[model samples]
Target: MADAVALRQALAAFLGDTQYRKFVARGMYRGRMAYWQEQEWTRFTTAHPEFAVDLNELAAALLVCHLHGDELKPDTAEVFHGCMDLARWYVEARSRLFPYAAQDVISTEGRPFEGDRIGVLFCPACRVARAGWRRR
Candidate 1:
């Protein structure tokens, strides 16, 4: 199959399954509205290897659509753009919220001290740090 079709199929499979779709939607709707890092994307797809190729290709295409050809290439950008408003909502909602209270839990050995870990936070689809702190 052509690369685009294969990638789309992969993405469709990922999106067709409720759980996998929810995870991608969460990342796209949550976190920052920026392109995800290669490491992060690989990590996420590794957790769902069945859709690894599709996710990687789809994500790359979405980045291209998002960055260029937004005006004259609306159709090409629809999939990624579909998540823009939701991302905006996440950004705004998190911005209006309050910061979480600092905890005194025992630190894990060798783990970086970057304040709180993203796992404990109410993460959006992006999986990166949110724009601000907010109570869940």
Candidate 2:
């Protein structure tokens, strides 16, 4: 069975089911929407019960498709990590710029959120990067 122990251990060079599932969740709050899939949402939520990310296009497309070509690119891991870095800035900036009145305030509006247009994320692809722009 692929568990925490198995995931920490990297015997194979290829991206395994366990690893891919985790990656789905990581880019989730960060970026790498191009790699996300609806099916993987379950695994992501299960693996990271502590996180309370909403399953929305905005969260999914937090980062633009900075990546090009194959899903299993040699530097794919780095790209995922890159999202992790952006996540921090996102939180801080959101607080100052968006300044959610409440935790749920972030949800009041939808993607293409009314914030600064900075490509702090991967590609500023989604509605932000996903949409080819960036949220504050």
Candidate 3:
């Protein structure tokens, strides 16, 4: 139920923490930063049950943001905005029973790449929903 602002703030805080930076560094060195273990995700979800949806959405947004690059560019910024909007819609609509509803609504896949670097891994649903935002 958390909003995009809260999700962004939480993600920033989590990523800014020294421990997390070190964790990322270690993962990078081990070539494991591109993926997460199921248990690790479970622990994160267990610790922050309230932000689960937001966290998932934020992860997807960050990946898309990385993909677009140059956040200052108008087109890239639009992509970020569109991705966030799509994520909010996905969260709101996920509980309804309907025909042609999106499947695999949360991304469980490994991190998406930006050039040679590993970006954040996002849910499959968000990725699908944001496809339109990508530049031709």
Q: How many residue pairs clash in each candidate?
A: 5, 12, 2
lDDT of 2 at 82: 16
Best by lDDT: 3
Error of 1 at 132 (Å): 38
Residues 27-133, model 3: lDDT tens digits: 33232334453344455557667666643553433332222221111111111211223465555554322111223332323544234222233334434444533
Between prediction 1 and prediction 2, the one with superior lDDT is 1
Tell me the tens digit of each residue's lDDT in model 1 across 26-85: 434333423443454576467656545544445443431111112111111111111123
Q: What do the candidate models score in CA lDDT, each in turn?
A: 0.36, 0.33, 0.37
- Tell me each candidate's TM-score: 0.22, 0.23, 0.29
Off by over 4 Å in 3: 15-33, 37-40, 54-56, 63-136
Clashing pairs in 3: 107-123, 107-124
Candidate 2: list runs displaced more than 4 Å.
1-36, 57-61, 66-136
